[model samples]
Every structure is written in structure tokens, then in C-alpha cells.
Target: MIKQIDKSNNLPSKISTISSIRMIFSYALLKKKEFILMLLFMGLGITFMMISPQISRRVINILENNDSNTSVNDILLPIGLGVLISLVGAIVLGIGRYFSAIVGTEAQYNIRKSVYNAINRQTFSFFNKAETGDLVARATSDIEMTTPVFNQGITLGFQSIIMMIGVVVGISITFPSISWIILLAVGLFLLAISFCAKRMQIAYVKSRKTFGNLTTVFRENIIGAQVVRIFNSQEKEIKKFRKENADFKDYTIEAIKWSTILRYSGWIMLAVMSSFVLIIGGWQAYVAYQNQDLSFDLGRFIAMLMYISMLGMPINQVNNVVMNFVQANAAMIRVKEVLDAMPEIMEDTNAISAENIRGDVEFRNVNFGYTSTLVLKNINLKVEAGTTIALLGTTGSGKSTLISLLPRFYDVVNGELLIDGVNIKKYKIEELRKQIAVCSQNIFLFNISIADNIRYGRPDASMNEVIQAA
Candidate 1:
């Protein structure tokens, strides 16, 4: 059986939702100019959209009056202006979307780069407990999910809030009595939002975790294909994979169910508010007409209805934005876990850098364990320069562990490991590693030229040197 390392000990402290969101915003700061430009364009688009309804109201009022003094230009001018504003708004919104895409791509790249570097920095013990497939999922699927949170979730969410505010203000100014109706509808919408958001968050997090587990199952099966074939365990592996796959599907379905309900509920609420506004506004308009009050005419009533519809669009979008935020929050948590991990081994500021080391190694009273059980105990060993030695042991023996200590793949818990008469920890990790190498029992070769493989340790090596090493 393969020895299992305690993963809990290796994992970093869990990051809270607020902290994860803060980190995402900090990452966005890397492309602050692009993000700001996108926001400005979104604001411009919303401003134009808010102005369109007023133009429509004016057109209706002019046509309703049917004044003999009015020319075609009187109606045509506002109609043309409304179209122009809409066209300009579409163009500006498109530009904003383009910038948002660029910003999202750049942010994703930066995050992946940071995560890759952080993973690389971890010691072997960290990888011993980590799954290759889970890491792959985080770097790819997780990053992809997170991009929309920054671009669509935050940016469009801000736009939605601004638009909603503008709609409320416009309605308040145009029809004060019915403005309370809009506010009441919005208040109820918020209550529904809070309840749905909590449930969606739980479902999304579970879904992401299940997906990671499924990826791990697939990855391990592929990597160990030969072993499985030899043992004729294909059926067993398939059964295990199916179980994980089913769990992933179930979790995903649960998440979709909640999100779907939230989305449809938003539409339902908007529809009800729209219908209520229409009924009340129509009654008030009829009353004003009866009283010869021209202010609350059909034109203003129609504009108020249009404004309510406009408000609904953004309110409806809140569901999508919340969904994205929940997924991004989960992905960010996974990513931040890796980034915040403390490497088991760290170089001291005062560590020395050495050159031209003699090949002398020593282990004194070494005691080590991956867990509670010690694998190496009070071991003493020494090898002189230019000497050859062999460590022979059975499958569960500590042979690999013994050799691994020379390069500090792991540090001894209670002893000193030395090279060339100085403690290995005294030497800069990179400088110390440069002078030693181990050809493992299970070798892995890259899909590159033989010359490149030979030069893997020293990319700056000349062709002649690579040939010599080969």
C-alpha cells in the first residue's frame, strides 16, 4: 500500500469569503486602468439608456396633443435623437465588454501564474498529499470560473446597481406617488435575494468540491493505466470513477436547481411589479384626465411603465451576478489556500552560497517521519568524496527516504545533515542543490529532444556540453 500523508497538516488555513473577495480585488488592481475604462463605458451606456425613456415620453406627448402648429421635425427630432442615443449606448457597451474581456483574461493569467509559482515552491511532502488532477482543475477550470466574477459579476453588478438607482430616481421625479411602489417591490426583491444567495452559495461550493474529486479519480486512473491493466482492475476502476462522476453530476444539478429558481423568481417578482405599476398608474392617469390635470398624462404613465421594465432587467440580472460570485468565491478559496501555504523548507536570509563543492555527505543521529511513525531513527552515515554506495532495501524500507535527505527533499526532525563539513541548511537551497542529483528508480522523461532533456538542469548549457552530458 502507498503510504498516506496527513493532508490536513499540509493544508493552509482556510480563507474566509471576505478575504477571498479582497484578494480578487487586489488582483484586479494589476489592470486598474483597463477596469476603470470598462466601468466608465458601462456608466456611459446606462446614462444613454436612462435618457431614451424620456425621449419616448416626449414623442408620445407630442403625438397625443396633435397641435396644428407642430411640424414633422418636432416629432422626428426626438425620435432620431433616441435612436442615436441607443446606437451610441450599444457601441459604448460593446467597447466596455471588449475591455472587460481583456481585463478578465489578464487577471486570469496573473492568477494562474501566481498559483503555478506557489505550487512549485512547495516541498515534496506537500505534493505527497496533493492530487495532480485537483491541481489541474484549480489551475484551469477554477481560473476560468473566477474570470467571470471579476468581469461580469463585479463590473456588471456595479452597472446594474447604478441603473437601478437611476431608474428609481427617474421614476420618483416623474411619478412620486408610484415611486413607493417601486421601492416596496425592490425591498421584497432584496429579501428574496438574500435567501437565495445563501442557498446558492452552499450548493456552488459543494459542486466545485465534487468536480475536483471527480477530476482526481479520472487523473489517477489515466496515470496508472498500465498498473490497472496488469492487475485486470479495469472494472473496479470504472466503478469507482462512476461513483465520483455521479456525485459530481448530482451536486451540479443541485446548484443549477437553486440558480434556476432564483432566476425565475426574479422574473416573477419583476412581472408582478410591472403589472401593479400598470394598474395603479392607469387608474391615476384616468383620474387626472377626469380632473383636467395634464401633468400625469398618458405619456408620463407610459414612461413610468418603461422605467419599471428597465429596473426589472437589472434586478433580474442579480441572480446571475450572485451565481458567478458564489462560484468565484469557492475558486478563490481553493487558490488562496495554495498561495497562502507555508513551505516546509525555507532558506535563511544569511544562508551561504557555495561553489565547487566536494562530494562528502554525512547524516548524524537522524530521526524522521512523514507522520507519527518514524521512518528513519538515529541513523548515522557518511560518504567520502568521489565514492560509490548503494542503499538496498525491500519495498517498505526507507532506502529512498535516506537518499532523499541528501538534497533536503525533507529535513530531519531531530538531527543534522551535512555536506562538505557544513550543515546543508547553512547553504543556500539552490546553491546546495546544484552540486547533487539522484537518478530515481522510476524515471520520467519529458517529450523533448534528448539534447534538451540532458540540458534540463542547465538550460544555458551549450550543445557541445549537452552532448558531453548525454
Candidate 2:
């Protein structure tokens, strides 16, 4: 399915965005060496492409000479060489395609791994600020946007450019007098393309971002189905979904509309180019005949025409790659946003491991809040080993807030918290959390068997132990 991500409004800083994309592409290329091989094959195929046209010109000259010195073998030899080059080109192109696909898959795998690692290391605050659906989109959907760009765009896309250059250069060198017609047509097409492409790179990028936002909404609603159902907010959710869907549709339509225009416009340019080249070449051939320098090789013209026509495919591929890069550039911006984020909670590099310690906890004039809203007040408290202190308060009375401080979920606003006569912040977060477990009234089961739930506390627990806990 042609999933459209409409996000033409949220484009990021270009330098950072392009840097992120380059880094990913470079890494993916390294991981999949076959892509490099495919690139080499593409180069070979293009060289063959250039040779086909020249061979045609050669064959034409041979056949047209028809002098007593010329023989069928003369014509046959170049024809055979052209066919051989063509055969080799076809085989190499197939190999290049195979390698490209393999490399693309490998690149996707590496990108997914990098995104997964970044998501895993993200702090709770980051998650709270980011949508679950958005994160999932980055790991799954966004990575998908990059696959084609890496495989075809990074490898064959450049090869196609080289191929186009080879065709142009080959034609210019062989038939310089009439080449200007082709060049003129090319210049006009490029001008039209440049005008069409002016805002498209930016537009497609914006569209992709909108799609990400839409995916985030879809992800959140689906994952939080229970909340939506319990609240009976189906209508509200549907309305929101429809809105996002409409926005995506609009942006996608715009991108496709322009892209289609550019594509057809390019095709028109190619057609005009062909007619121009044919007319000018035909005239030149006539002039050469009058000057006794034109021995027309219809075979060479046919071959040259074929070579010129082949340019169309790579041109299309190049355009597609440009669009792909722009779209991936968008995804890269979103992905980098996560990778570049610095966690709010600080970690201790010099933390020490202390065993055989009592779990003594204390709070001294602690004050806390979420943003500007104070959730806790300045207060003093202490808890020694083996102490049983109950928090008595009505709902929203800061009991949960106070207890949360014990684990350093939120650092005190104006005071200090100590555990084992040491500042809680001094200990590594994981080490500190390991010493305490809060069994909430609402348990989150993993949809696994009962044994698994008990085993969650101790993954290495014995079956007997799990059974006993259950």
C-alpha cells in the first residue's frame, strides 16, 4: 500500500537533518557490502550502455561503406560485439538489483537496531513527553521510509547519474555537430524539473512528518484501547483520527500531484529530445553524404537511439531517489531528535557498590513539584531499617508523591533525600531501585502464563519458586 505521510510543515534544520541522514546511509552501506558491489556492477552496466550506442554508430559506418574492401564479417563483428555487451549489461544489471535488495534489508536492520537502542536508553521523562505510537512509528514505520532510499538511492541512484553522464559524453564525443539539439532539450527539461522540484523536497519532508504525527495518534489510541473504552470516548477518538487522516490525505495528494507533474514533464522533455536529435542527426547524415563523409549506418543510429532511450529509466530512478532521500531525510530528523536527546536524570560514574547495608531512608525539608505546580511541600521524614510507616491521606494528598520520592522518581525541590546515610542521588538509579519493590494495587500482567508473572520479579527463579509465589 502506498502509505502517505503528510508532514510538510515540520521540517527541521537542514545541516543537522542532512547530517543525520548521511550518517545512517554511511552506516548502512558499511553493514551491507553487497550494496557496494552492486554499485560497481551498476558502473559496469552503464559503461556497457555507453558502448552500445558507439557500437551502433560503428556498425552503421561499416554497413554503409559497402565498398569492395568491406565484407559482411565487418558488419557482423561489431553487431556481435554490441549483442555481447548488451548481454553482459543485462546480466550485470540483474546482479546489481539482487545486491541492492539484500543491502536494503540489511540497512533497515541496522537502522532499526540503532533506533531500538536509543529508545531503550531513553529516560522516563522522554517517554512521557513522546507518544508511544510515535516511538513505535520511528522503530517500525519510519525505518521503512528509509529502506528504498538506502538501497536504490544511495547505490543505484548515483550510478544512474553516472550512466546519464556516460550517455551524454559518449554522444557528444561521437556526434558533436548535432549533439547541441540533445543538449538544448536536456537544458529545457532540467529547467522545468528545477522549477517543479523547487519546494518539493521541503514539501515531501513536511508531509512525512505529518504522517509520523498521524501514526503517533493511531499508535496511542490503539495501545490505550482500554482507557478509550472505559472512558466511552469512541466518538472523540474517531473524530481525532479522521482529522489526522484527512490532513495526511491532503499532504499526500499534494506531493503526488507535483511528483506526477514532474514525471510527465520529464517524459515530454525526453520525447521532444528524441525528435530533435533524430531530425538534427538525419540532417547531419544528409550533409555528410553530400560531402562524401556520410556513410549512413542505420544500425548505428538504431543503437544510438536505443542508448538514448535507456536514459529514461535511470532518469525516472534518479527522480524517485531524490524523493526518497527527501522523505528519509524527514524520518532521519525525527529519529535523530531521540538519539540526540540528553536524559534529564544524571548518572554517577564514580558510584561505589556497598553490600550488607541497612535500608535507612530520610527526607530533609523536601519540596517538589511538576513544572510550576508544587506536588509536595517542605517536610522532614526518616525511616530506619525494619520500620513500618503507613502513609495516611486522602486521594491527591501527596502520599504517592511522598513515597515516590523515596525511590528518587522526583528529586526534592528544596531539600535532600538520604538512603543508608548517603544521598540517594549518589547511588546509581538501578542499584537504588533494586533495593525496593512497590506492589501496586493495579498489577500489569504480560499476558503470559501465571508462572511468568511471578518470574518477572526474578527472571532466573526456579520453576518450584515460581509455583510457590503463584
Question: TM-score of each candidate?
Answer: 0.93, 0.89
Off by over 4 Å in 1: 1-15, 289-295, 462-468
Structural RMSD, model 2: 3.7
Pairs of colliding residues, candidate 1: none
Cα TM-score of candidate 1: 0.93
Predicted candidate 1 versus true structure: per-residue lDDT over 1-470, tens digit per residue: 11121233122223467788888888877889998998999999999999988999999999988899999999999999999999999999889888887787788889999988988898998887777777777778878889777677777887898898999999998888888888988888788777776666666666666677789989888889999999999999999989878877876787788788888887887888888888887788789878998666677877888898797669766878888887898777777777887789888889987577787889899999988789999999999998998878898789999888888898999999988888988888888788877788887789998888888889999999987777
Cα-based lDDT at residue 105, candidate 2: 79
Q: Which runs of model 2 end up more than 4 angstroms from their true locations?
A: 1-11, 32-35, 181-198, 219-232, 287-304
Provide the overall lDDT of each model, using Cα atoms, as 2-decimal numbers.
0.82, 0.74
lDDT of 2 by residue, 297-321 (tens): 5655666677678779867876787
Worst 10 residues of 1 by lDDT: 1-10
